[model samples]
Target: MMKKIVPGILTVFFLLISLQKVQAWGFWAHQRINRIAVFTLPPEMLVLYKKNIEFLTEHAVDPDKRRYAVEGEAPRHYIDIDHYGENPFNVVPELWSDAVQKFTEDTLQAYGIVPWHISRSYSWLVSAFREGDVDAILKLSADIGHYIADGNVPLHTTENYNGQLTGQKGIHGLWESRLPEVFGEGYDYLVGKAQYLDDILDEAWSGVREAHYALDSVFNFEKILTEQIGSDQKYSFENRNGRLVKTFSKAFCTSYHDMLDGQVERRARISILRVGSVWYSAWIDAGQPNLKELIKKVKKGKKGAENKDEKIEEEKENNGHKLKIIDRESSDLLGMRDVHEMLFGECEGHGMGVGHGHGRPNKPHTQTAQGQKEGLWPLRMRDL
Candidate 1:
């Protein structure tokens, strides 16, 4: 009786752990998007981004981590376009000011503001490039990549993101997380070099529209496959991190992957190109700053113990603002918890909806393009 009880307790404990992981199971894709985007950069911007590849890759999921810790952070990760109606693009205004005027800021926050947030973050990235702030540039680059990647996910754009409303719960992780975890190695990521966008806002909307267009296929394929397969064949326990964890069976994933007809790979490839293009555009907007100089300055600043003392003094002069920036950079290096691992424990509460803490109840506060020049960081760093 005691031995049996111990096994039951362990199963319960692991299930709880898996639930936490499902919330962030998509972190791997986010990190992969940022990492691969580095290769898409041109020689000019590539010099800086490539040197700090690890920083960009690791911090790609920083926004996801802030979802629970930061108040307004969750809304930035997604937008529920379906909440607007059948023709959301026509109903919702493209410009942030226009959207706020039409829907009221509170209403907008209650839904989502991802596209607008992407535009806002792009402006901030441009400002960082112009100011030649290495820390800010790198941080914002990683963050914008995360948002752009989210924009490409069909689930991130819908009200029934996790399929809770359709009774096919857990489809979110199955599509975005498990499928990639199993077959991503074979997916082609060579999306070609990044191209410049004339209007970043238009580009952001286009990506969201494309992803939204694929929304039906995302759900329909899974439903069809579910009907054909029994529960035992649909899911299986596998060893992950030295623990038995339940996940979508490889055979089921393969069938779903085939049904999608390369949709997942296509979206991921587009995300990579878009991320790199945005980074390049920001640099171009900043008058094509010599990124090599910024790299040199960073190297110079790290030279000696004497220079470190001077850095401390400089931070004191700036009221520790510089120290705060350094601390943030250090935190990125130390790495945050991968939200994907939390999915392995339990799969509940993973819905990307307004009520599930995915959207902010209060209005979002953002800096104008002009304000970013004065070093006004947006909600990302402010709430953190």
Candidate 2:
């Protein structure tokens, strides 16, 4: 009786743990993973993307669900970058080139793309194609959509990233998830073909730089308009969770539109459209194949097995864990209870249309961000 009860309790504990992981990665993770799949898509699958908009429709919420032919390609978030260094930013984009050499197949025995960092996503696709599998390609295409979508976001690339700032807190969700929900679908999906990137690191760093520059308007333009426009016009009343709430105002939209000079939405739409195109491009580049061939070599999703077998498999994976494929967090951070996780977890509370903390901190960063040379330091959670 004791043995039976213990097994059941263990099973329940594991299930609960799994559910939090599903929730903690947030909507962006799903989107980012799709971009990985995009660069590996085959020709037939590529054509399907343009012929139909259904992919975008069904996947906008959780795009990473599309499994690539390669097992374990779509993975849990949190790159194991911390293991390699004290601070990734100190090295800058050099990490990307290093990743290329590391993935170039020195110690690695298999012919697959490595998942070193979230930013190295594109490099993985470029190499995965050499293996030549259709299912693998499509899987990466779906993942590509996710990353490109995240790229369009201003916060994902910034350190002030989450708006732990001057009381305009939770602006991260407001800008990326909220605004897109209300206004994104209406965006035009007709962007030009994705030009082949000669150097992925250059493109990636360029993206980071672009997102960095946008921080000026995202963080400052709101304040600039406040001096001239009335407060009421900058927000609107809406019912959320049966509660009447004042949200962003028409004047705020107008001001942002002015700040972007009308490029924000267009760029977003371009990102989505390019996501599809790249997915297709990857399939073509990957040597368009029959998905059936790849299906023969790989299986989809995990299946339940006997307890002993499961234990053995888990132990095996744990022992052989590769930095190229794993993301990690501190034991304390990973072990926090649900409510604690929701408040502090990477993927909850502030996502989408939820909440914004918008305020100053008791202690703020003395320095500003990279592009903000005018100030003593980039304004952080304290300045808002």
TM-score of each: 0.76, 0.50
Cα lDDT of model 2 by residue, 241-282, tens digit: 588867676557656656756556655655655555454444
User: Model 1: per-residue lDDT, tens digit, 305-374?
Assistant: 3455442212333432332233343333222222322222222222222222223343344545543343
Instruction: Report the poorest 10 consecutive residues by lDDT, candidate 1.
Output: 345-354
* lDDT, candidates in the order shown: 0.79, 0.45
Question: Highest TM-score: which candidate?
Answer: 1
